[model samples]
Target: MTTNTRAWRWGQLLALTLGALSSLHCVELPTKSYSCSSAEDCQGLSGPGGVSYVCGSGGWCEAPAGSACPQASTPPTCSTSNWCWDNPLSEGRNLITVRGRSATDIWAVGERGIALHWDGTCWARILPGNSQQLRAAWPAAGQTWWFAGAGGSLLTWDGANWTSQALAEQVTFHDIEGASGTSAIAVGQAGALYTFNGQQWRPQSWDAGTSPAPDLLAVWPVSNTEAWAVGRNGTVVRGVDGGWSRVSNPTSVDLVAIAPGADAGTAYAVGRGVLATYANSTWTASSFATSTTPLNGVWTSAGVTRIVGPASNIFVLGSATPEPSGTSQVLNSIWGNDTSLWAVGGSGSIVRRAGGQWSEFPGGVARTINAIWGTDDRNLWAVGDQDLIMRRVDERWSPAAPPEPGAFRALWGSGDTLLAAENNPTATGGSNGKIHLFQNGQWTPSASFPSNGVNAFWGTGLAPVWAVGTGGLIRRRDEAGTWLTEGNPNTASAQFNAVWGVPNAEVWAVGAGGAIFRRDVSGSWVSQRPSGATELFGVWGTGSRDVWAVGLNGSAWRYDGTTWTQVSTGVTQTLRAIAGRSTDSVWAVGDNGTITYWNGSTWMPQVSGVSENLRAVWVTQTSVWVAGANGTVLRLPL
Candidate 1:
């Protein structure tokens, strides 16, 4: 598609400096369990928020407590100051571009201003204090690396300190390349072209002769004096002798990426089914693919050409033998020399091409998490879309061993007994609602129940389990271990989202259209209405007397064993789930990364470093855990 600039960012440079490390108090970290004989084995080890680690006396890795880890220098505009993504080690965010000077020293940047680096050991994430989409990078051997992204972000990192320059324009820079540390060219939306010559940045004008100029997506610098940038609708421009101008038309398939060939004046540009090359001072375009398979990136080194795109498609120019990509994930960018190569793309996918084989490195799950529960930090479980179930054992997160796939929307467990509630909202007639029971090391579907979807679960310990679901379906398991249907409290057509209570004594389920149902002492389901609230999605409490329910439009309600009353939650974002460690340590999370804390009296907001809709929250005595869209899990110290 032809490009027109949409949402833009104009940012002021906010610089932060890192201090040298010194003797620090050690904090025993959870087990990554990489056995080390010396300190070097733990060098590249990092945890959430890039928490630094060191080789401990036990021949294991541990974190240096209170050490300075790079975080946002700006004070959180919300309630609390510390919130970090805790799931999918390495990095869970999608990687857009990859570049490096060597196999070990590599940089991959992607959505949400996330940068990952490989230091001859393991991948470590670096947060540059910005959350905008980053899609451009430039790497020069033995020199500082350059990264440009959305919000006019331009920054440089020297493996130690960071320096940033605030570009005045409100545009996203898609690609940046330079000949030396001093000279570089960047291009982005609306045909933006900027040149940096060591001292400062100066805008270079280029005309597309259209109302909205095409986006300049990729840039390749052959030398300090020559470069090329390509983008939508055959947008190709060249820089030579300190001037920039439009290039001759070739293909109009929206060239996304361009790469230099084996020699000067030789390059390749690729897009949907089209591959265009430049040589002998002329541009040639041809059908590179039999079908319209979009090629996202192209690279060439010492006569080897590799093109990559969606579904693990890797093609070499003039060769029919396809590269053996071990992963089926889309590849966004490729860079390397003759000896080694690397490609990164969607869903934190990174694959290495070395020893004539391609292998994907282990990364985190990228699905939307629906619920999070656990006994402590060392043992936690999270379930999300597509039957994704991840477990944290000894503080290290990994997918549970074939936990039998199921869409679990609510999870509750204690000690060895855990239950996962299936999120089925489309029950037609029979007892189609389902649940999963965990045993040995895997999860299996339970027998049967009413409704098609079970949205929530609650119980005393494990024996008497209570569940609620779509069509206001409710069920109970008695001492005889038999699951039986319960009354729907006159709201059988509305879907229930959450359930919590004492097994047989009391239970509460809340869901669609502000519907709230409670099972009283006499074991009869009754409406908790006059609820005066919006669609409620979650219900929780400290005990039988005090309870809380949260839902759409930031609605919050409290029950003191008698009636449910509404409370004002300053913000208006939809709240999906709520949890608390006690009366004063309650947290509710919802859409747009919303996090609010209830410190006994008033509810306040906290900043989560993500934009995916937050759906679940779990609070421990010392920390708060929240899970949501895109396998997002955030942790903040209490």
Candidate 2:
């Protein structure tokens, strides 16, 4: 099959920035927990806005507590000023494979063509035009490297920039291997090959005539023709001078990563705890002492072969010795405190490891911790599921006492004043998702909260507070503690997940369906919307309109007062929170323990030790704090 090198067109940068773009709309109620049971449930002044949410089994919609707050339904007002704005250059990142020769030369790759490099002291991001999912990367020489991914995407890195290339066949590029910088090859879906010369990338044609085209995932090349590729359908292929031919593989469970030993025709491939070796054209399969988990990448370093998968499965080859495995949950994010590590996942499971021993934090309530952050190990916080909030203290876990018997989904704070939000589980419970503040030790509930659940909130020291929630809930509190509400520009129900403020008046918030709102000098909220299905989750700002917001499905937006624009962060991993002590030192955390840094403009990915669901982030001049489910707490160096 002839592979075509598609020309680069002006494509959308997959990176999401703070307040990049947004739209306005009234709130709509879903039919599930946060959903609506009837049309009247969404009845605002504009009829059923679809923002109606069923308030448990009772047929009443949860309206705000107030007089003349219609028994029929209350109006869904804008709630932008009460939330965190987006990060202008904060991008979503999932560090799938972390490999390094030295501390300064580490590379991690993941979905959305994300390729991030660490240079000992700091991290940098490289974006290839293709948003195709990237799987693995191997540095061939100085700065020259090769990466493989979906859509048959192949990329080569010269000392400076990344160039997109094509494979011999249009298959998902999975793995790459070579003896040195010059003799490297990449393999992917089907028997595909693309070799790298010193200058450009070109396909290496093999005349196998596309037999069943097994889903090739990894490749290790001994010589040019004496190369091997492994994939799904128990497929293994050997490359000869004329073409690539399939060899018999024992298992069909999709080999994800592979590595060649020091000798030619000697290699190892791994998938779901199944390890196979290829020698003299025959494949021999064996099981290791390692847990039968899905292994993603394998490598042979210093004569020892190690394999890593989603749950930190580290396996050895020569002795078949197994190391302790990481938690096998589909971890959404990760964080660490001075004494604890936390990993949150599906269900309300929050796993914590303190003193090198892993355990589950007992929140009693099974709720997902979507975001986490705090000042220190003893002052950590995590927010998620049904408005859940968990806190850590001296390595002990405690439920961050709920504001009400409601769900607290997002959180933010500065100093002793803390602001938390509630996404009303049922819209009919007269709990329009209130914003609660922990000042000193009292849980003070604010008036005029959200007409629905509050997704995220940000606060300065204590004097004034900003909170945003479901249904464009934009409410602000001035020095006098009076709640001011604003109307959204759009009629659709947009859920703002995050909010941030520079001062009492200069504030911003971001939300679902690409909705963004900004507060002017006069302390009034204005609506902004970007196009697409981008759902903004977390927001932070240096000033009034200069803010950033991140959200579901890896969407990020940036606000610059006059307009909102999107920036590329390479990875499409869902980002949950944004925090920066200074303009050049911003930190964002999210699902899969994604940690992306913003050097003022562009967002770069960083390694956050753990891969659990990180819920929130707080950064000071010299310290960074992240919190997550399972009592996960993390503190970073300045």
Candidate 3:
């Protein structure tokens, strides 16, 4: 018999047994027959093998013996109200460098040979037919462009078509600069530098005697005869009289980028926490005020200088303070015209600076999504690594202000009240847990909790919220907004990964080594370790008697009042989260974008187009939402 047929047979046997037990115990049982408008409504029911029930042609639930279960044959459709994958335009690809002649005409290149263009209104990806990472791009007069990257890949765009140019060896090209389309230079690993003479590229030899060759990172062409290249270990080279010569070094930090200043013979080079200026043929180094963030890109136009780096730091020359772009994304390249400035970085981060303020643009790129919660279909929040938080409003996702500078692991709330659990890092390379309350459109630190990392939260949005985390830690938030430490049943410490509760009094926490705890009527946590030693990551239930927990090694357990039984999931991948509309209908998501459904008697896998690790799952009566690594948000019909 087929899988569905076997499942149906088991269900029928179970239903018959339950029916008999209900009569003996004076309990109620659902009738075997059901009315339905669609197959989904008729699913999760009990029947005999090869006699599974489905929605008939007349729209009523009926058994069609020996028929196969319906299969998901096509890709799930994404809609504002239905299933969809919401991510940035880069599709989780990191954009390394961006260049544009104007705000309307822009091009960005990054890993996997991804190329994107902006035509004043929207961005579109252009296929380059390669997957190697593209490291640098330079736009030369009118539609002509140059892209260089890994494996010695060099591509030239001539307004209409892109053609690859061969090189002698595979080497990464870091940056490109040009005085004109014909007179340009590129720099890369191990002292690699090349010059383009309008027709072909030629390698330039630099003499360094017996010293090691420096990896050139950036080049700035003030003129064909006078250009500068900066690289590792403070190696600086000046191109003069048609040859390259070593220049005096100011600091040993690896210089990443160079830009010309307002006057001739004046320029600025920045790298790692050090900013250097070259004037009168001498370079001088100075520390950026109160900034330890490594600098990546520098630009100067009309004497207005801007430097961009990690943590969205933007330092303008002559300004007393550094302006924060309000994002924690690492900016790789910065460029713009007189009216606007753009920076691209890790996690599909793209921000624009105009009117003396920086604003982020929605790219739908995937970043790691660690936790997700929502009050309704539209008002949803997702948090992840690098202080990333996003909120959905009117079907559009936008970044929300981070509660604090740390990775958020869990969120729980209802209506306008919500709480977030964060792992705040310390200077000594460790982390501690903290809680933040969301109120009046902002997130603020809540009462102090334990120092251990908080991993999960569950409550009714009222007083007495429960949080579980490292070291078997359990804390409760009372109605008076004070956090009180609660003792767990386990004398030995265990890491708690997830928590779910029916109310303030009855709660369940699951974690490492198959550890499970439930709060007793006496307000004490008692160990309820089920079968197996697989680490449990998520827990949820329809009621106290129908609780379910999913975890490592594809382990899933269901609690039926008195006993916990193992449910066969048939896969070994770690299952992260579980949600359900009823005990008979449930869903679980996990690593490798795995999504499995439990229909009464059997568990089956569903195809998720993505391949990232799915970390969390949430379900309602009609919809299911999943969040995963690289900001992947997927919604589907329940």
Candidate 4:
């Protein structure tokens, strides 16, 4: 076809797809074809929204570049103090190890080459070019730092730029400790050990008495002549007389971290539910009366000792028991001065214990958000596993109580009245589906259904609510606040996943095995199965005639007041939820940080910058909110 003719046809197609003629003139097309064999050939071609065109599989330039959405130039404004992407006061990345010269100069390292520095007030991120997970970090002499991590990543920061070092062998480095300006010891997986002596890093060999070496995880250097290293399978080695010798390991747990104790000739080691102390050349098992969580890092200073572990656990010796931290994220590393202590862990969790009370910071709750609902952007509710419910008020997310303890599957509501569907297991080895209501700042048990599980919820308000679940179960709440079971209409038993509707009794529910049902004015659901047997997980629409459903294997279907037609999403990730503000602008999120946007005609993928599974999405006129596994919460302005 001629270039002008094709452009005209494309404009017409977009106009028809959006059901509007006003947007027809905005469909800018290239006058000449860009020659390309792959998508890279079309790079830098100007398109809408400062985006570049990409070469499609058909060798044509497609609108919207394959880059992440543009970062906000300014941080979001909120009435209350909250953590946003641009204002990164709190850590949102998993931290593995922490070290510092003093309280004013602290460093924490973690996955994705994350390095954070604390300047006595707040934390700031330092980007190391490599994306490898940094497992260990230590301070050297005078503003110099050393970092070792996965894939043989050994980096040195000379108070300015980070430089990578070449090593003899390519292996992951777990721990590094500096004894002096010219000497340091590092250990890693599979018994790999190396020492840095001013000029270069050289491999160190140890004599194993006919036993396979275990993976070393941590190293602590007391002096040039005395150092200790701990590893998997209860391996503990001490350095003396310029040589390493095996020390008695008291526990079989894989020792992850070691630290000096309160006094001389005393050290502590902790790992997988085991804590051990070495005193006067003898090892003894130590125990904590309160916790058994797998410990990761230990630190001691000013006659005080602290141990941190999974589930936000921090045990302080010689201190009274404080309140529970109330966070579920695993604590990976800890550091402190005499008066204050800080712990970091999975999902960007950072907590501080000061004045004998543990208080959580604003960043890093890595719990998967299964469902999100709100009256608007500021007033929102998100539900997830372990009875986790969060409320976003004035842009900050805080914990909210659920009616009971169970994983929530879906949430929907209007002003002042919200409902959550939960699948609570019964004592008889079966499931009990319950609907919890939130109103007036409290959560209460509202209703229960006979279904084994409740998966999705939809409602115009509190009066007429619909819930779908396993085995083709459907239930509804009428205006009289009474719950009633609407029998399954599908011929086959399909697990319903999501439901959405508009006014006038037009509701659509989609589920596994390609099951699609719609409720009529008579309150009876009728099957509306489309071709193919793909399991659908999410459904939403701007109106009755404009609806979309997404499912497994990148399958998507759209309804335009007629038969449902399949829409092609280039990737095959399992999409879990979809939301939008208008017919021409919609989004769908799924596993492995997949986010696809429907720009009126085609579904284009957008980079989320995370590898966690996204489970739910909520949209407002000017913003989009997505929640997913590992306490991940993302927001973007429309």
lDDT for model 2: 0.54
Q: Pick the candidate with the highest lDDT.
A: 3
Backbone clashes in model 4: 8
For model 4 the local lDDT of residue 343 reads: 76
Instruction: Give one digit per residue, the lDDT tens place, for model 4 in 540-608.
Output: 997768889999988899988778999997768999999887788888989987888898989988877
Model 3 TM-score, 2 decimals: 0.66
**What digit string (tens of lDDT, one per residue) describes model 3 on residues 1-638?**
00000011111211323432222221111333244567886675533222446765534444563232121111223543343665555655778888886776788878777777766644555657778888788777668889998888789877567899989967888988888867889999888899988778889989854355788889999887889999887889989857998887888989998898878889999988899899897999988754466798898866798888876578889988887764556778888877777888776667777656665554433457788876335345687876666665223355554555578888776544567888876565445888887554445678544458888887765466788888767888888878888974462387889988776356888998898888866887788897565799989887778888899978999888788899888778899998877767788899987888888889987777667789988764456788888677788865
Q: Give lDDT: candidate 3, residue 419.
A: 79
- Minimum summed lDDT over a 10-residue window in model 4 is located at 1-10
lDDT of 4 at 452: 68
Native-structure RMSD, model 2: 21.2
Overall local distance difference test of candidate 3: 0.72
Prediction 1 TM-score vs. true? 0.68
Per-residue CA lDDT of model 1 for 1-638, tens digit only, reads 00111111100000010110000101112323334567786776654335656755544444454332333122222224588657544345778898886666778889877787766544556667678888887764356788888888688888776678788897999888777768888899898899888767788987777868899998888888888889988888888887778887698888999998777778999988899899998888889876478799899876888998866458989888777554446778888888678888776667666656665543335566788876445445687765555665224344442234356677766434456766544444533556776543334566455445777777766557787777667777665656787875386776888888753467788988888888887878888865467799988887778889999999999999898889887768999998887788788899998888888899988777667799988776567888887666778876
Clashes of each: 3, 97, 12, 8
Residue 413 of model 1 has an lDDT of 67
Order of models, best TM-score first: 4, 1, 3, 2
lDDT of 2 at 525: 69
- For TM-score, candidate 1 versus 2, the one ahead is 1
